[model samples]
Target: MGFSVRALDTDSWAAFAELVEANNGVWGGCWCMGFHVKLGKGRTAQQNREEKEARVQTGDTHAALVFEAEKCLGWCQFGSPDELPEVKSRRLYEKGLTTLPDWRITCFFTGKGFRGRGVADAALGGALAQIAQYGGGVVEGYPEETDDRKVSGSFLHTGPMSAFENHGFTRTRPISPHRWVVTRTV
Candidate 1:
């Protein structure tokens, strides 16, 4: 089935919540806010959900949500450097960061039973298209490169190297053994 993509705007908040809820709040109550908000003590899944919902309601949420008909199946989060303070590898990324990217693709979350079926690729493409609408610039992403090694879907929240490459992103530098900073001048 073909999919449609849209920004995580107020109108789409319900669909976004449904997708995240289906995934158990996404990575242990992350609510796709790992790069946007710091995790703290006493945080609960409900709190995360509420915070994310508030962000969406206030138009602060920046993500591309993929829908097969009306069901949200996947998402790709993107934002300006200031909006996303930290990434997976802060130190390494900082070392190679000569300049901040106009936008950063921080995370991807595909619903259960929907992975490995081009959901992520669609999300990334949707994100780039949205960025282009806002006047494109340097877009950065940090994705894991397994190099033929077996890796779990849970470990690919930032997405995989091949998906980024498929969307025209090139490796800028290595952040970790299996993670690299990829970029594209979209």
Candidate 2:
């Protein structure tokens, strides 16, 4: 089964929302906003949805959304450091971070019933293609390594390290146990 990729913008917001909504707003209503901004106290699912839509409307966010004939399969969110400043393991990442890359791949989602079907690979490939279209540069991704362990799909939102390696990203350093910073020139 092949899937097509599209940029996340006003035109594809509905489809993106559909995927997230079907998954109960994703990450407990994160809407994949975990990297974009800090959803502090008083943040609601509706707020996240609205904020994400607002960002999409103003071109403040970017992602490669995968679809199988109009139904969204999943997405891989990528953006500039400024666009997405709040990353997981912030302290550890900053400790090893010398400089920021041109782009950062922070989030990914492979819809329910579609896990392990290469959706992540497709979404990742699509993201790189889109980044190239936006002017290729150094790209970085933080992914967990699931070499011989069973990790719940729900917790692998940042994607698997193996996928990044398959996409030409070399391991840079380990930020946490089982998680590494992967980089590619793109």
Candidate 3:
């Protein structure tokens, strides 16, 4: 069957959370909020999870999820400009990174059993098309590119270089040796 995508809603949070934890547990509990939320000062992992869920529920329709038939297969985080403080607050921003008023693609997670079936690519394509439906502007993705010889889940939260590039994203800047800022101007 074909892969389909939609914005994650409150009703689907359980499945979404499950996908995150299941993948994160084996990959290390990144929780997908490691860089986005402050989990250090005093908050615990559980608290961070709650906060992220709350944000997902109350925040604008930003995050997109993919499904194949009845199974949730992948997810891609996207939304308006200010929704991603983690990326905006980075040192790269201070160094003159351009900002678009539309949405940005920040994180991606393809479920354990659905990694290499073109799930991520299909989800990303669906996300871009969905956002564009409402006049979404340029889409940006900053994925990490670790040595292919030693690749693993932990090394790819933002995504991989070839994935974004294949989806029409071009390298805008090198955020790090492994991470790069990519953009597709609409």
lDDT against the true structure, per candidate, is: 0.90, 0.91, 0.72
lDDT for residue 34 in candidate 1, whole number 0-100: 81
1-186 per-residue lDDT for model 1 (tens digits): 599999999888899888888888888888987888787788888888888888888877699999999999999999898888779889999998899999999999999999778889999999999999989999999999989999998879999999999989999999999999999998
Ranking by TM-score: 2, 1, 3
Predicted model with the maximum TM-score: 2
Better of 2 and 3 by TM-score: 2
Q: Pick the candidate with the highest lDDT.
A: 2
What's the CA error at residue 33 for candidate 1, in Å? 0.9
Question: What local lDDT score does residue 53 receive in model 2, on the 0 to 100 scale?
Answer: 96
Candidate 3, residue 122: the lDDT equals: 76
TM-score of predicted structure 2: 0.97
lDDT of 2 at 137: 96
User: Mind sharing the TM-score for model 1?
Assistant: 0.97
Runs in model 1 lying further than 4 Å from the true structure: none
Candidate closer to the true structure by lDDT (higher is better), 2 or 3: 2
lDDT at 106, model 2: 93
Selected candidate, larger lDDT, 1 vs 3: 1
Weakest 10 consecutive residues of candidate 2 by summed lDDT: 153-162
What TM-score, computed on C-alpha atoms, does each candidate reach? Answer: 0.97, 0.97, 0.83
Model 2 has an lDDT value of 0.91
